[model samples]
Target: MEFASRYLLRPSRICFPLLLLLAAAAAAAAAVAVPPVAQQEQDRIGRLPGQPHVDFAQYAGYVTVNASAGRALFYWLVEAPASAQPAPLVLWLNGGPGCSSVAYGASEELGPFRIHSDGMTLYLNPHAWNRVANVLFLDSPAGVGFSYTNTSSDLITSGDHRTAVDAYNFLVNWFERFPQYKQREFYIAGESYAGHYVPQLSQLVYEKNIGIQNPAINFKGFLVGNAVTDDYHDYVGTFEYWWTHGLISDSTYRILRIHCDNEVSEHPSGACMQALETADAEMGNIDPYSIYTLPCNDTGSLRRNLRGHYPWMSRAYDPCTERYSKMYYNHPEVQKALHANTTGIPYLWDTCSDTVGNNWGDAPKSMLPIYQELISAGLKIWVFSGDTDSVVPLTATRYSIDALKLKTVKNWYPWYDHGKVGGWSQIYGGLTLVTVTGAGHEVPLHRPRQALILFRHFLKNKPMPES
Candidate 1:
């Protein structure tokens, strides 16, 4: 099946109304900027059609944040509804540390519509996320997606720290443009590499809040799904999951069990070899049965199941064809706004540099430093998982949490509503972790109802329901 087909299910009737209410409220209540700024803001707001533009209203617009990066990069903002109260603004970031949020999350996963192959048209995803809160999908770090930088070197070397800084600056600037949202309980949410993005950014916000002693940042919480939080366990889980699912041969499992070491980072170590031997043996019959585990040929498996592998990409939208280009690149207004040539870059914009010859030569490794910084500052931190995901497996997330040694209640009982295994929640210390059954990398997309429940609990600053 094509990539989009795997995740391109019709939106959920159950969750669509909530998203619409939030989006509508936010748009209606938003105070358009005044003066010259007012005119532009009004015009941009005007672009938001009153009714039935598509599945959801498409307000293709950009925010210019004042950043140390010098030039203001372009970012598209799509609001569900305008609310008078300045509804909680959820900043959605898509990972790859290099992908476009609009193309992936909005167009494919939780946005209002699916871009037809022609791209000019759209189909509504009933399950679009805007129903919950005012969702702002961002292309960050100045180089990825619609956001960009003129300097070539900047494009070649964007790292985690730079990403966090740019994103933090972007939030500050975005709030400035629409100041009403400044105190609207902000959240940093994303998936995949975002495992890295959300936590680091949260740490910065937490630290800044402490400095002013006034909680200026107001970073309420962060949500990441199928995140790559720790490199060590994530990699190990790949092979271990493969073995458990019967995708690798018995002999291969033996090898992996014998040599599996979680910390070797050079070219695949002896442990990795053991894992690979098992993966190699069971490559062909692995699938269908092995859909839940990481495949033997990671690269090849991804290519074969690109759509399924990456839940964010539009299974339907073609980045090249005229229809697709026009919707994005050729949109006369978007073209003018971007200040780019009539024919902009072909592929969808990725926020970070995915340029050739650009490698993150092991500079420094410190996940704990950032985690400690956030904890020391008292930021509301949340880490959730799709119980079934092998990419950033629940086991790995569990291991990471164990190290935290936060106070715990041994909270691991099933939560049911209308009598089915809805999901489960656990609260240890101030931090929280919940696992949604049957969800994969993108929890929100896969398990919207449960994900929404989780998010709502976070917004309310309440512990997840104890069932």
Candidate 2:
């Protein structure tokens, strides 16, 4: 007040022009406080084709993880409600070693939208996980969905290591693109081959953040559904699931146990392959991904279902489900709205890439080592399973968790949802395992309500509710 009075009293000495300039500069600084975020604005999605009205902000675009390799990963960020700002960020992936998260996770499972049967319109999934967190669905490894790589050979050797490294790079660059999300509580989640992707990426992110006091990634923990862990365990548990579920004969089971017991080779011997084929034949046309659900009768998926272990790449997409994703994503306008296909790649976008999965070069025999390291680091790790899924069934997950040998913190118990048994849960020293009774390969797709409940608990770092 005194300084202002002195200025007022000494009006003759005051510089009016300088004062005006100072005021103008202050106004400019105030305007800049929000940050223009030009690239983020450019990537903003106006609306997707036939997408229903939504209040939350949405963005979809490519972030270059490798310039020399011409590799870029695509991502779709569906933010939480305005009130949920400063909430945690969740990255969801779908494993095919080559699947598109946008096609599956976003369009069908945990994301905000689901495509209608006409393949032209969309409906909001009430159970969308984004209601609690900012959900990011990424098409990773530069070869799936809208992601691209000019270096042709990259896809052939896109193994676990490269996938993890590139994904870390993507997160680093993506944070730059949306700087506000940097340093937010972050998590990685997925199902299927993503069982591989989720952990590999989590380990990389955790390692990269070793020394930084406040790393931008700020990774919290991870959760996976029916993830592939140890190859031997997965194989053994899978065969058992088939037999116990009555999908295969006792003779076939014995042959499998005899010929497929070798843990060394993921590609079993000719004899083991024959036994697996025999088992697939006997299983009939049921969707092995979800034993009870009706299989997609589409000719392509139908033939592929009978292939050995290959059907793990296929989910329970009926005639209208994944079929709808194909039609909606392929529409040029849809791509335009999402800022996708900027390079005009020759191939049409697909839900999964056969070339990438077929040529995956370096899959470690086991992810148990990574699990042990992360667990000891005190990172929150949770694995959930759809009990009915034969591909990576509850038995497989249990065997893998057992191998971790962590002391049990809470014994197994039924978890309730809406006054009914939703599933079963057991909490270990550094991990939690839950099983959704009748869910399939993709729990969110089969039991969305239960999946959402599970997501809420994981984010809270709490165990599933006991009835």
Candidate 3:
């Protein structure tokens, strides 16, 4: 029996500072102290230059995933061709902890193109991932977008485990909507804090497969873009990477070294926050990871900073003065499609809020233990990194996987396309790590070609591209 067409969809927590004073201070320090990793990489590979031109074409429609609790999720399917038999199914989740997948995935990342300033137009991206396989972009966990829940309790703190459960449940129910793809090889992929979501969900689904005695999950593997997995090394690596990149002044580095990095435990303290604040203040609007030096703050600099930091990902030409979000939440189509309760709520949707009850506090101390459980349960895992992301640097990913100590079936090798180096892939027991050359936090936005290549290999079980 087929399910209704409404079968749907799918962070991390990010707190924006009320004042940019610290951030401004951080920016100046970042400029003077650090060498931009993002710019250096961009220099190495180069970009489209000038304004990137995107051509937009409407593809497929949305699916509503109905939950027992009465909430629903809206999902967009980037379909593969009819000839793409038993095609790989990819469920793409974007991390805000509260950001919309449609905003990033469809617009900035790999869906197809950029949505124009008018909101009615689009430009096609030459590097969309769907060229290789079917892609599903989901806004998840009730209250994120169109996804909603019946119970207020449902809106409580979100973490790795709860998110995993909801996502796994979404998969089970989503199959009811698109039954045709039940047998298709399925993969869960995303970026940023999705590093935590993908693996945790993969682990949950794999466990349920054993408990339910069903093969429906069809879970071939899990893929993450610059994902945040292990808490310990990732947090520590942030400072080390900052110092190495010159974002942290030597004195500040020494300060962080003695106080911040060393003090990491199960739960962090004000000292850690202070250290991060120091780093954040130093980096300011200019991305510590990228080579792009931002103009100093003017009166309207906060909005400028927002746009500059997320140039490829944000739609706003001027985020501060225009207030794209205020206008966005007010759009009739957006309002009609979204389930956010704006009644007295400051934001139609809270991009970052402590009050929303999604208490996904921090990354776990050790993610390697989760790996043991997944492998023991017969799951395939893939960890991919965008080498230029300072937030969740590639080195952190390496350290996380290295802790797994998996037997190396394949050594590190560069992946090539059109005789150009695209990325590198390393295959170990039940897992793979692919690092894209010119990607930042969001691979689709920065390195769509490489992202597509990685997705194709994941879904089709195709061999890694030759260098």
- TM-score, one value per model: 0.73, 0.87, 0.73
Local accuracy by lDDT, each model: 0.55, 0.79, 0.58
Cα lDDT of model 1 by residue, 278-316, tens digit:
465465533221154343335343544656765633343
- Model 1: per-residue Cα lDDT at residue 320: 29
Error of 3 at 445 (Å): 0.5
Regions of candidate 3 where Cα sits further than 4 Å from its true position? 1-69, 83-86, 211-214, 262-267, 288-330, 334-358, 361-363, 376-378
**Model 1 bad stretches (over 4 Å):** 1-51, 54-71, 80-85, 116-118, 213-216, 257-262, 270-274, 277-353, 356-358, 361-366, 463-467
Using TM-score as the measure, the top candidate is 2
What are the clashing pairs of model 2?
Answer: 95-194
Residue range with the least summed lDDT across 10 consecutive positions in model 1 = 1-10
Which is better, 1 or 3, measured by lDDT? 3
Instruction: State how far residue 49 of model 3 sits from its true place (Å).
Output: 28
